[model samples]
Target: MKGRIVGVVLAAGASRRFGARDKLAARISGRAMVQAPARALSGLGLSRRAAITRTPRQPHALRGTGTALWSVGHRRPQAASLRRAVRGARATGASHLLIVLGDMPGIGRAELRALLRHGGLHPAMATDGRSLAPPALIPRRIFGPLLRLRGDRGAGALLRRRPDLRRVPLGAGALRDVDRPEDLRPPRTG
Candidate 1:
């Protein structure tokens, strides 16, 4: 039987490079950048949809996109926040957790579904041919090590330890995360 799958949007980035504005709150295609991933994951009808923030006052838009709000308290590292989100997801009886990045406004429902398909059997993560990263599906078997993660390393450390990560090929759209002002530009036309 397939285990329950939960979605968690990691929205706690400091956006130090974005210059004076939170990238997740920046508008992309007329909507908050975080909304894209939130909607994509929520549309999958996962066991639950949630967003992790560094503080309580971050932004209120994610909640409207159907994601429950969570905070890791003050400016904790991404890994710490993710660890807390994982524990919260497990509490919902989830056997799998889909870690989505809030800044990836181009991620869509189809991409999330693709990750979910392989994630049911083993740990799966999306790859843009250069690196395997979030928009990943982590199985419960590694939840312990995941919870043990600390500092700003995020999940890369855990992924590196396990060579079994199923790398799912994803399009440039799925990999386009908004980190700086230039990233907010409109996509070029064919």
Candidate 2:
């Protein structure tokens, strides 16, 4: 079945904890880390529904092809950015939203598509058998909860507030993201 979900790439973050630069803009496989998530979403046919970024004054390089550029208000937390993304997704008549992170360079398109096929209104979250985070496929039924998100944590907190979360295992790549200088370095070619 076709997933009615639109993809939202959260490319807005301060990266203050990392302290080098915007980690999402850091490179991987000859492209910015943000590009990986953007490409993955494009591959899934959600390119037309994407919100590439929520930071104003960023280089055009950060904005991938066919993605809408938006600012979630500077100095705001990640949840604010998420709220903006969900609103955009809803505006496009999407039944669900696949929230992909800007720093998750290793998330495969197929895995996301698998989760999409199984998505539902009870909050289908991508987990690595340990913790859950984006890329989460949130149904429109949870849009109100998403709008109520706070700080930079995003929707994982919502799962706690609302029981009955459908957990989808994304394996190792789902648990990975570019958070430090070392994280952006290319893995050794064996």
Candidate 3:
């Protein structure tokens, strides 16, 4: 919280499980799923904010949000996009990298703010009282390990293994991500 924190939205994943359409482009509520995460990060007014995508064309939802769009090779692994974001953040003198998944429309400003508040000087990641995952706040010092991540691997595993990682508890459904079309449906109310 003392230094510049750059928010990075990882949106380059191929929607293999979401059928032919891009999952990030799909609407949740009235907004594109990807926009939810980007808007949240943008609202924080960090030193800088960027969204990584597989295409050079920017998403309509990101327009006017002041979040820069960075494109990586199509179908590249999650780590490739993440590494690209990390490098960009470092270039801008970011002291911490706040990572959010574009598919996780459920994550909002509240959860993100919590991560920053409890993040301290070490890495802090959101937990649903169970598994450790992103919407992670990672210090610049940890960027080296993130740059070494390979293939489809993400920071989740690495964060889980780190003794210095702080787990910030969020609501049960806060980390829910849309993987299939069915996941977009609102919860049934009995």
Candidate 4:
């Protein structure tokens, strides 16, 4: 039988570095940072698309995004949000999950498509020459360890433990994520 691919966007961070505002909602090039990746996922034609966050309510920031609600409890850690997304993906009979961070402004549909093309049954992540990070594709067989996670720590733990995780190299631009105001700057064109 063929497998179903589910798109899961992780957007529940406190954005402590962004001062008073949620970085995910922050605009880069006049569009919310979260929307960049959300739009990419929507373009993938996945069986289901879910965005997970711990905010009390879906941010007005996400209005009209078209991604479904997959929120975790308030005050919960990032792991909680991830667990919720994973469980929901499993419930929908998804065989693989494509996990992308919500604050990434450089995420494009082409880059997302590249990740899926290289990712096989095992976990596959995008690396920016320095470290492995999201825009990762993880198979159901690896979901067990993800459910055992706690706190705000994300897939780093799993990647560290599993040296076997495949990595697909991406340019620095595609790997850049928004954390502070400066990170929202448009990429240099010269």
What's the lDDT for all of these models? 0.82, 0.73, 0.88, 0.83
Residues 37-130, candidate 2: write the lDDT tens digits.
7777766755255654555565465554556676776678888888898888788788788888877888778768867766765667777887
What does candidate 3's lDDT look like per residue over 169-189, in tens digits? 997678988899999987666
Error of 1 at 40 (Å): 0.4
Ten contiguous residues minimizing lDDT sum, candidate 4: 54-63
Error of 2 at 168 (Å): 1.2
Off by over 4 Å in 4: 187-190
After superposition on all C-alphas, the RMSD of every candidate to the true structure, in Å, is 1.9, 2.6, 1.3, 1.9
TM-score of every model?
A: 0.92, 0.86, 0.95, 0.92
In candidate 4, the residue pairs with backbone N, CA or C atoms under 3 Å apart (3 or more residues apart, or in different chains) clash, namely none
Ranking by TM-score: 3, 1, 4, 2
Per-residue alpha-carbon lDDT of candidate 1 for residues 1-190, written as tens digits (9 for 90 to 100) = 2678888999888888899976887887788899999999765768888888887764766757877888887767778888988898889988888898989988999988888777766788888888877788888888888898888878766775677888888988778878889988876869
Report the alpha-carbon TM-score of model 4 versus the true structure.
Answer: 0.92
Question: What's the C-alpha lDDT at position 137 in model 4?
Answer: 87
Highest lDDT among the candidates is held by which one?
3
lDDT of 3: 0.88
Tell me model 1's lDDT, rounded to 2 decimals: 0.82
Distance (Å) between predicted and true CA of 169, model 4?
Answer: 1.0
Give me the displacement of residue 95 in model 2, in angstroms: 0.7
Clashing pairs in model 3?
none
Can you give the lDDT of residue 168 in candidate 1?
86
